[model samples]
Target: MQLVALVPAHDEQDRIVATLAGLYRQTRRPDRVVVLADNCTDATAEIAERCGAEVFVPVANRDKKAGALNQALEPLLTELADDALVLVQDADTVLAPDFVRTAAVALDDPEVGAVGGVFYGEQGGGPLGLLQRMEYQRYAHEIHRRGNEAVVLTGTGTLFRASVLREVRAARRAGLLGGGTGCYSLASLTEDDEITKAVKTLGHRTVSPDGCRLVTEVMTSVPALWHQRMRWQRGALENLRDYGRTPVTAYYFRQQFLLGLGTLALACFVLFAVLNLSVNGWQGAAPFWTAITLIFVVERAVTVRGAGPRAVLLAALLVPELLYDMFRQAVYVKSLIDLALRRQEHWYAT
Candidate 1:
């Protein structure tokens, strides 16, 4: 079957060439590669073209990745047959040589509508960078272990059958997705989550192949990491709201419930620690807090072990990453409230 790779990029000149090169190296090369150069002041289009990709630059507001993707979709669908496969990837990610081949083989199963693969973070920026690397490694391992039953929430390196895309597009047009927004834009930070849910709602299966992998570069600084996670958490909450009262489907409901429980657990821990300190002084709660912290450190170490020694060391140095993640969840809660209240969501860089 013929396949097309769609890459949405914005000011990614430095990284686009490497990503395209990786695509070229795929064991099962895509029939065509389309790069959506959204609002780029740089030479992203030039680089993509040089690397043998068909490039499109949208003049309209490049709201975000989703917008660029939708803009590219119409042209691609018009040019290719309806039965073709379309793979979406990020400009900063590099796929393994066999990644596409593996995804294609998995999609060969008629029941599977979409497939996501393992993604690893490249290391060596700093201590925080190492923590990010370890986090990605743990994520890859968990998804691999879960196999096709995994619930995928991100859209970094995923493949979709053209039929699924058409269904999603139709749902968007009928105002069944994203609270009647008429085809969600990439501008809405959580468009990926929305799309994934939409596809699942149509009774098609989404799978993650253990053998397919992609290497990604993580944010090196604490502030950058904070922004990245905040966007993700906030988007997730927003999408959950958009689904409003749909009888909790097992897969989707379980994912949301776990996130909510995790948030509640963290909040309870902080509140208990504060109240104990206020009533009995630091001495009384000191031991308990230390023990809890040690437990967290050990858990982090175990997770980082999958990435090797350097990652473990980085996890040790960045022990506060969990707190940072908690902060992101708090931001997500706030963002969800804002979205519910109809507050505007301004676009920002990643």
Candidate 2:
């Protein structure tokens, strides 16, 4: 089967070389590498070409990454065979040398439609970056614990059978999926999450093998992280809303509800603590509560232990991570509010 890699990029001149290099270094290198340059004002296309990757610029596409990819996929999919594989990856991600090999192995299974990467953050975002790394580590541990059954086919890197993508497209056109008529939903902020539901709805399974690992860019600042996550959380809610209550979206709705419940629980806990402190003098912590807290702390530490000393230390400290949790909770709350009001949040380009 022909293996094609498509990197959808917008002004990624600074990192295109490394991305291409990672592809070239892959154990199961792609038969062809194409860079979808989406209205780039920089020399991203030139740099990609310099690195010897075929460049395809989407013509005046305003729908962002999803549109650019659709434009490129249209003609390319026509030329490729049904069994051919397409690796849709971000411009800034670097796959492990064996990523392609591992994902290919998983995709060889007729039951598996796509294989996504187990991604970690790239170094250099400071304390915030470290926190995100730890968060990602915990996420990776959870996925591993679940036997690599993926909840989403992350954009960082994912391998798909051309046939499956064609199926997704057909499903969209037939109104079996949302987004009207595309492999990805232009209306959905979190295309990955939306597409995951689409794939599953079509009776195809997705996997995230541990061996298929990659490093993708992380938000370096609080504002960046906030906007990124807001878009993610809000997009997910919107996607679910669009898809409605179907068997495929039942799990996603539960996940979102639990997140909202968690946020509310945290708020209630803080309020109760303040009220108790004001009503009574400082009372020592209860043994039962302390044990529960310990369990949580230990779970945090153990899950991120693989991230190294600093991550474990941070996770154990509790304060930093707790504050980060509060921040994320705030994002979740805001997303819900935005979704309720049908408020429009401008898409922020990374």
Candidate 3:
């Protein structure tokens, strides 16, 4: 397979070199590296060129990341041969040595349209950074249990079969899919999810394999994480809205809708628990309180344990997990509300 790595970057001078360097040292190096230096005033394009990548700066769709990616990929994806695979990497993320090899292997089945990597958290920022590491490990472990079936393809280290991308492009042209974002669906903030659904719509599979691994930076602060997740949850909601009961995406749509309802129920339960405690003090709510404690035990022992001893200890500590859950729930509620209101788009640096 001819592997072509596509990186869409905007003002990423501070970190693009590390990304390129990692690609250069890959176990299965790409045949070519294509960088979309979108609206950069800095040395992003220059740096990418120096690293031996063919750079393209697209004029249209410069406002959103999905747009930039679509602008860069539009003509190329439709024309590349089926044996060619396109690997899309976020500018801030770094790949493991064997990432391309692993992804290439997964696509050997021919029916698999896309493959994504398991990501570890980037090391050493602070306590919050440690938490992010733990969070990613736990999440990755959960997804790993899912085997090859994936609801969404991560952008960090995703490889796409050129044939499937051509199918997606044709779908967009025939008006079978939304055209606002071009091939990548710029209308929704989470274009990755939209593209995943579109790929599935074409009777192809998207897989996540353990061997295809990478490292990603996490949001360092509570506010940063909140905004990031809010956009993600909203994007999930938007994808569901856009693709409603369409055959290929009906399962994910129902899943997210039910998840929203379940989340809303969780919020109500929390309110009721607080009210019960307020009305009858700690003694009457002991069982409820105890159940909450057991949740921490399960979370630590079953979930975050993979992150290592520190994560196991922290999950038992419960404070961080509880605080993070509160923030996540708030994000879900806010995202749902905003989507309900049809609020304007919000963008942030990756």
Candidate 4:
């Protein structure tokens, strides 16, 4: 496969170097590397050019990352061949040397339209980083369980077939897909998830290949993590709503819809428990709550073992993790309410 790599960036001067350097070291290096310097004020464009990447600073961009990507990819609709592959990697992530090689092997199946690799949180980030590391490990675990059929192709390290992208491009031009530019939605918060559904809705499969992983930085503070998760959860709800509007269920959209319903049911159950605890007193609910807490801690511990002993040890912060999970749960609930009320939400991009 003739490979072309794109890194959509905004003010990524401090970190883009590592990502480019990692790509340069890939066992099967991309034939072309384009760094879409989306309205950057920093040295991001200069650094990408200095690093030997073709830099495209958009004339204008409004939808953040997705818009920047569309601006960059619009031109590629004419540049790519049917046999070409495009890897859309995040500015903040670095990949293993063989990551591209491993993922390319899966594309040989012809039925696969895209490939999403496993991702780990950047190491040595103190408390918040370790917590995020564990969280990512759990994400990887669940994604691996589902094999090659993926519900979402993570932006951290997603490889796409060029033909499907062109099709998406054409669809967007015709106003069929709702992404900001072509394949990625400006209206949705989680463009990766939207792209995954778009590809699947076109009758192609998304693959998850083994031994190909990306490492990315995670939020290092409570406030940052909260905002990030809120944006992510809200984006998910919006995608469900948009997909519902399309009335399409050929691929994973139906599965995601069902999963959303399941989450709503679980949230309702939590609400019932909270109401009972408030009215009947904690004495009666103490045993039930303790068991649930222990289950959460144990499950976290088992999943976090991939990060080594230190992370497994951090899983002992059961109380803090429990509180954090509760916070995330509340975010999920608020997201549902926001979607129902037709409220607008924005990503707190830095």
For candidate 1, write residues 1-350 as lDDT tens digits: 77999888889999998899999999899998988899899999998998899998876854677777777787666666666899999899899999899988988888888887677887677766666677788887777677655366356788888878877777767766653332334535767677777777777788888767888878877667666766776666666665765643555667767877888888897899799888988674467867987787777777869788876765665546766567656776766577679776554676
| lDDT per residue (tens digit) for residues 170-268 in model 4 | 777787776644767887888888888788777788887767788997998878877888788888767766776453344445654565676667677
Model number with the top lDDT: 2
In TM-score terms, candidate 4 sits at 0.87
Between the candidate structures 1 and 4, which one is better when assessed by TM-score? 4
Best prediction by TM-score:
2
* Better candidate number, 1 or 3, judged by TM-score: 3
Worst 10 residues of 2 by lDDT: 175-184
Pairs clashing within candidate 4 = 179-184, 179-185, 179-186, 180-185, 180-186
> Compared with the true structure, what per-residue lDDT tens digits does model 2 show for residues 194-289?
888888989999999999899999899888998999888888889888889998889889998898899889899889989999999689989999
Residue-level error in angstroms, candidate 2, position 16: 1.0
TM-score for each of the candidates: 0.86, 0.97, 0.91, 0.87
Off by over 4 Å in 1: 178-187, 247-250, 274-298, 314-318
Candidate 1, position 94, lDDT: 91
- Per-residue lDDT of candidate 3, residues 180-200 (tens digit): 636687677888888998899
Clashes of 4: 5
TM-score of 1: 0.86
Preferred candidate (lDDT higher): 3 or 4: 4
